[model samples]
Target: MNAQTVIVADDHPLFRSALVLALRGLLPDATLHEVDAFDALQRTVESGIDADLVLLDLHMPGARGFSSLLYLRNEHPALPVVIVSGHEEPAIMQRAFDFGASGYIPKSSGLPTLALALRAVLDGEIWQPPQLKEAPAQALEHRELAQRIASLSPQQFRVFMMLAEGRLNKQIAYDIDVTEATVKAHVTAILRKLGLVRRTQAALLAQRLLQAENAALEVPAAEGLPVGEDDDA
Candidate 1:
């Protein structure tokens, strides 16, 4: 049988290294690839590496909130993604699952817990911390917004984010290394797909989605549950 391939995507060097070491201990025969930013991760995916899974960080450069997760879920529906984030709020965890994450691992989790969570996910089970009381439902508006964002082509998604950042078409062309005409075309498609009539409306909607996510993260950190143990363990 072939060994598994796992991509660890996180910007924090020290934590990423520790996670890699722990992953090595847990899956010694598996091939591991590391990327520090969302753009690097996108490049890795586009390179056709046949990764079995991706461990993604919630806050990474070139990605905002759940946009990265949405992009991965849209572009590669078969690939599994497990979110590893510092935020332990139940709402955030629930939101991750609602957005199609196979699992959510809080950064405070112990190595043993991390291993258990990975094992479950690799075995095709959706995993979350045992302390979660119930599944928090996502708002209907947020769900609709996510659906629209997920409908965009990968390049269109990038253009959408740049538009939200207030980058003009020329600036976006330079940053993405595409011609201005190409950017304009992407913008037109984005507007049509999102049902927005103008660029400013797209920007405002994107900002609204971002702010909603940021508010979820701003809620006081809930008390963390005991780590390294699951119901079946």
Candidate 2:
């Protein structure tokens, strides 16, 4: 039988390890891949692993609230994603579903609930906390903006993320191994696609979506979970 494939994208080593441990019992024959941030998760999917599901952390580095969720829903429409987040706000959970998350699992959930959530998603069912009521109506303009951002090409998306990170054109060029002119072109395309007038506006938008929490609180190692070696392939 072909092994099932799952990607766990979380930065907390201990919690990620604990997740891996729980997942083993649920998908014993599955190939589990791990990633630390949104960029790594993007690269993994782009490399064509065809993961059955991705367990994503909402506050992971390189991701802003709904930004990564929008990108994944747009770019890999077939892939199922179950958000594994510390944030348990009903509004946040609702937004995840709106952005196409297959499920929302709070970090504090016990192993059995986690397993149940994963099983439901793998069986092609959408799962959110039963306690959460649907969020208030989202603005049409906001929905339109999400679709526009989702339309970005992978390279353009990468460039957009770098711009959000406050990297200069030359710095982005160096990091992505592209020429400065190419980076500039990507920036232009990204701005045009997002219907934005300037890089600062784009950056601010990313900040609002991706960095809602304080930067220092981004990647706390989960307490009481035993640490395990990272699996980044």
Candidate 3:
């Protein structure tokens, strides 16, 4: 198998750089790219950069909540998206899932945890570690939404995420190096694919998925799971 390319996007330049450098050990020979905010995230992605995977910040500047995940899905639906966030709120995780994140990892998570999450998604498994939520109704709601959003293509997913982040179509097109007409076309397709009504509904669904996904990462490390920390591959 070829080394998977990975993009890490965040508002903090140093933090994002560190992640890219650190991840090289995880994906040696894997091309890495970094972008600071949602706008740059789109630009980096749409500029013909190649990546088999994306490490996206759920709350990067210019993008809020789970919208980034949605946008990535729309643009690169086949590419697995792993939520890289500083926030560990259960609700936040769930929203990531609702928006269609394949995995979720906290910033505090060490390389072992990051490796597990990344590999889990690449191996075609849901990337959440598992959690017990007190509210079954909330969990059920998220599952319903996840099922709906799961069918989106990467491009549709990216567009959906951006919409949830309160980004305008013009901004998205500019960032992605596409025409405004293309962005509108993508937005329409995203809505149809997710069976959503308004952009607000799509945004709400993204939030729910992200939160639901976050709720699932409560498991301890699995036995025999390879653990790597600060190792440069």
Candidate 4:
């Protein structure tokens, strides 16, 4: 029989160890790898580890935000990735889907739910534990926000969204491939267009807009899932 294999990535060693123990108990013969952050996770996968799925942390330092989600999906294509996060902010969760996460489970969810998410993915279905979706937030309008979004240029939009995540100016500059001065200029324009009072306001506006738009959209994965409706493992 083919042995199931999984990898868990988070910077928290103790937490990672606990999950490893639980997963080891649950899956028995399945192989598991634990990674501390994006670099470690990426390198481990690149080192030729055959992972059937990866449980990833979204907000860990160096996680590359949703970009790493895209990266992993891009690289493995068929590999399933279930987000293991402490942050259940709907926008981030939505972003995970946009980047092609197969499942999402909050760290606070008990082991049963985690196991269910893993099983669902293993069974060729995407999973998002219902309990995690109970988080409260004011609803925003998508079509209206899309109309508003038409005002920003592509570069300006990138800066605006990155800044909305509370990323520092330097980080935004680095991410958008512009001068810090250019980022500042873009920020100023974003503020002016949105009629914002401060950078914080702009950030908040961006957050609201992102949520309203439910901007997390699933791109077609670079690879396909396993070719059968059932598995013998």
Question: Can you write out model 4's per-residue Cα lDDT over 63-159, one digit (the tens) per residue?
Answer: 4445456557656768899988887676666556545679988888898898788788988899976753675543344323333444566576677
Query: Comparing candidate 2 with candidate 3, which one achieves the higher lDDT?
Result: 2
Model 1 lDDT tens row, 76-95: 87889999999888777766
TM-score of each: 0.72, 0.67, 0.63, 0.58
Candidate 4 backbone collisions, by pair = 98-217
Under the 3 Å rule for N, CA and C atoms, how many clashes does model 1 have?
A: 0
Off by over 4 Å in 1: 131-135, 167-198, 208-233
Provide the global lDDT of candidate 4 against the true structure: 0.68
Write one digit per residue (lDDT tens) for candidate 2, span 93-184.
75677557899998888887887888788889998775464546545566566556667786887776766677777788899999988987
Clashes of each: 0, 1, 47, 1
Between candidates 1 and 2, which one is better according to lDDT?
Answer: 1
Candidate 3 per-residue lDDT over residues 138-198, each given as its tens digit:
5664555565666676666667666646677777788788887787777777667655545
Residue 81 local lDDT, model 1? 96
What is the Å distance of residue 115 in model 1 from its true position?
Answer: 3.0
Instruction: Pick the lDDT winner.
Output: 1
Error of 4 at 71 (Å): 1.0
Ranking by TM-score: 1, 2, 3, 4
Better of 2 and 4 by lDDT: 2
Model 1 poorest 10 in a row by lDDT: 224-233
